[model samples]
Target: MAHTLAQKILQAHTDEAIMAAGQIVRCRVSLALANDITAPLAIKSFRAMGAKKVFDRDKVALVMDHFTPQKDIDSAQQVKLTREFAREMGVTHYYEGGDCGVEHALLPELGLVGPGDVVVGADSHTCTYGGLGAFATGLGSTDVAGAMALGETWFKVPPTIRATFTGTLPRWVGAKDLILRLIGEIGVDGALYRALEFDGAAIEALSVEGRMTIANMAIEAGGKVGLFAADEKTLAYTAARGRKDAPLSADPGATYERELTFDVSGMDPVVACPHLPENVKPVGEVRGVTLDQVVIGSCTNGRISDMREAAEVLKGRKVAKGVRCIVLPATPGVWKEALKEGLIETFMESGCIVGPATCGPCLGGHMGILADGERAIATTNRNFRGRMGSLESEVYLASPAVAAASAVAGVIAHPGSL
Candidate 1:
């Protein structure tokens, strides 16, 4: 049977030689992840299970990124507990302070993720690793604890859904638009518990960063993973990161339960407007939409490459007169790299305020909150009704390029002209 990338990776982790959708299967997890927010709960549960140590100390990665430099008393306590738990558990891959960032970005960059592996993280965006042809999915804290105590987890092999994108995307239409369009077609719960595999020329034309951006939002569409076949771009990315030995591609003739085709040749930049992440519409259709704030950062598109794309459009321009634009790096490593590349200068010169390498406005804990009737265009993942600020405010989600261009124009503008 021909299997999609997600199917191939899932099958590789299964104990059975063959499996099908809805069938229970035990999988051998290659790696498990927990960040500051989830690690404390996971540790508490693991201790409750009477586990002396993690099944494999090196197999688990504990990162402190969410509240790194702790914003409040509760967050400070969470970080303290997580650090103590990691050290006591003998977890060798603990990352704290400046070392912490978004878990997904750090994992692949550090060569911790590879093809044909099953990776799980407490964060929903763990599906991002599917870009590497890995069977990655998000789990709750209890699941993380179970994986810590026993290096295995059970899954009901998800049915496969294929999205074949044809034609070339316009200059401003990016991976974010592609995913948003798909979500618009299928709605939020359409792909619940399903594995989505992207195919065709359009997907192949996308860069690794773009593919990652697409995969990172799989959860928004209720998918287990959103994957693309490992191709030259994937190989080049891994190689440049000094992980030339990672596996590549799935077997040809992979099987899928269903498939969809999208013709995006002339597709315009799309935005997932507030109230729901899946409420999407083309930017042109929603032009003149005023915004009070704009934010560009998140695990979804906070890499150096992503920042450069946004900076390129903002080089000689300034943010809209009254609108505030906040830019954040996903990780300290990405922040350092951007500083070295002068991207930070470009952003500052363009009148964009830059924040530390924290989740920042993405998670709504700090910075860039909106007032009633206010609107914002952000590069972060979700746009649920009250995600960034007040429940009365509205958020429109787009790519880094679109967010940057909109920030400068004071309206929802495409990045194609810039």
Candidate 2:
């Protein structure tokens, strides 16, 4: 019997020599992660279960990125609770304040996750690590508690959906556009409980940051994991991060439940329009839609590459008056790198506000929340109603380049339009 990339990783972590799709099995976890929003609940569950010490202090990560800088009394208290718990458990990966970044980006940058590893987090975008060929997925707070205590978790092996991308990406089009196109084609529930195994020349040629962005949005398509084989690009990325995991691949005869192919040679910049990620349209189709704000940062497109893309577009340009453009770097390191590379100066010169590394605004948490009836474009993952602010406000999702261009145009426009 052959196995998909996800199954290969799952099998390595479990005692079972063979496991089929939909079969549940117990597997050892390489890392268990949660953030300020989710950790408070997971910590409470950890105590309720009467587990004194975590399975391994080094294996548990607690990040405070969502509502950090102490948004309000409730959020501050939540972080306080998580902070105290981290100290009590002697957690080695606890991060807050300047040390913390978006959990998904922070973990991989720190080499805490690698190929063939099994990772579970109390955050849905935890599938981001699957970009590195790890069998990663999200878990509820309670389930995260179990993994933290036992160092193992159970999963129903997801059948693989092979999505092959051919042809080179057009200028200004990137992984974000590709993923938006995919979600639009499949709808939200298209790949429910299935692994989306990305492949072909285009996917293999994508940068590590690009791969992570695509995998991070897998949840929006109802995928169990958006995986890619640990090919040269992936292995090189891991090696640069100080992770030494060997590459892994699916068997030649691996079984797939379905297959989808995309040719990116002619695809244009696209966006997920107001209210839903699946409601995508080419940027040209939605040109001239007014906006009140534009955000360029999130776990999805907050990497250094994304920052560079935005800076390249905004250089010698100004954000349209009345539109509040906010740029957020994914991590402290990424923030610092952008500053050193003069990207921060470029954004500030363009009249955009540079914020700390937080999930702010993306989750309607704070910092850049939209006013009622206001419309904004963002590089964040989701665009659901009220996702960024008031129920009446609207969010349009696009890549960082598109977000920056829209900020300058004061409307939904493609980067090429600039």
Candidate 3:
């Protein structure tokens, strides 16, 4: 009985001896997460369900990363309610203020999620944890509430799509380019309701941080979850964070509904054009698209590696006049590391503003909202219409390198072009 990595992880959390794709199964949750935007609704749902206390206080995490620092009265109220609920429930992982980063990044960094775990969050990027060989996905607030109350949630197993990446990535091109290329080829809904299993030499060669970036954007292609088999790199990363879970991998004869292969050896830095993650083009093709803002951070590309790359590009260079460049480290630890390594100074010297670690401008929350008709090149995950501000504003999604280069060029330009 061969099983895909996703199937194996899901089955491991359930009592079922054998599980198939599409089977309805209730599995224990290793971690349940909700951010400020979603936690309030989940708290209301938790109360509506008459759950006085969470199923496992230690397993539930309430993060105030989205609209934190009190954007407005409404947002402040939302956090207040969530904070009160967290205090009342004695949830062990409540995070806010300086302790909060993006939930997807913070959870893995805190060692709260690991291999063979089933994690659910009220936000879509929860799938980001699959990079650690965990079965993680996004659920609605109510479903998250159920997981909080019962320590479990039901999932309709998604069939697997195995995507193999071969060859080496070009300079200035990495995980962000790979994902943008895939989405452009397959459109936004290509892998709808399917589990994306990534493998092959190139994927294995990528750093764990890069793997998390790829997995973080799985939802852009409508994937139920994106998984990478737990390997030495993954284990070492988790071990460094104090998690020692056993590595998980798919059986050799594992089944997959579809197979896709990508040879990235010849790929160049790419960007998801305005309005959609699927609307992508090579950076060279879209060169000279003027920009008003350039943001180089998000759960997708706000890690220390991302900051280092951006800093490398911005070193001794100034952001183009009239362009507002904002850099956000994904978490507090990432921020501290960047500061210690002088990446923060590089960004500031380049005329870029270094903001606290928050989802802020990525979700149009605040800190760097765009004006109407303005354009931005960002290293964030999505770029739907009005994602960063006014409905007339536009967002181009690219890797941190491209975003940094574009900030200097005042247009969508390649790093090599600079």
Top lDDT model: 2
Q: Which segments of candidate 3 are over 4 A away from where they belong?
A: none
**Candidates ranked by lDDT:** 2, 3, 1
* Candidate 3 lDDT, 66-155, residue by residue in tens: 987889999999999999998998889999998889888888899998889999999999999988888889999999999999999988
Write down the worst ten-residue block by lDDT for model 1: 244-253
Query: What tens digits encode model 1's per-residue C-alpha lDDT throughout 1-418?
Result: 6556766776777768554578778888999899888988998898899989888989999988776668889988998898888788788889877677778888888878866779888989999988777789999988989998899998887888889899998887888889889988888887899998887899998888888888888888899998877787787777777775455565676667778999999888899887777889888778788888999888888988789889989989999899999998887888899999999999998889888877767777776778888899998888887888788888889988899999989999877654
**TM-score of every candidate relative to the true structure:** 0.96, 0.99, 0.99
Off by over 4 Å in 2: none
Query: lDDT (CA) for every model shown?
Result: 0.84, 0.92, 0.92
Instruction: Pick the winner on lDDT between candidates 1 and 2.
Output: 2
Pairs clashing in candidate 3? none
Clashing pairs in 2: none
Give model 2 RMSD, 1 decimal. 0.8
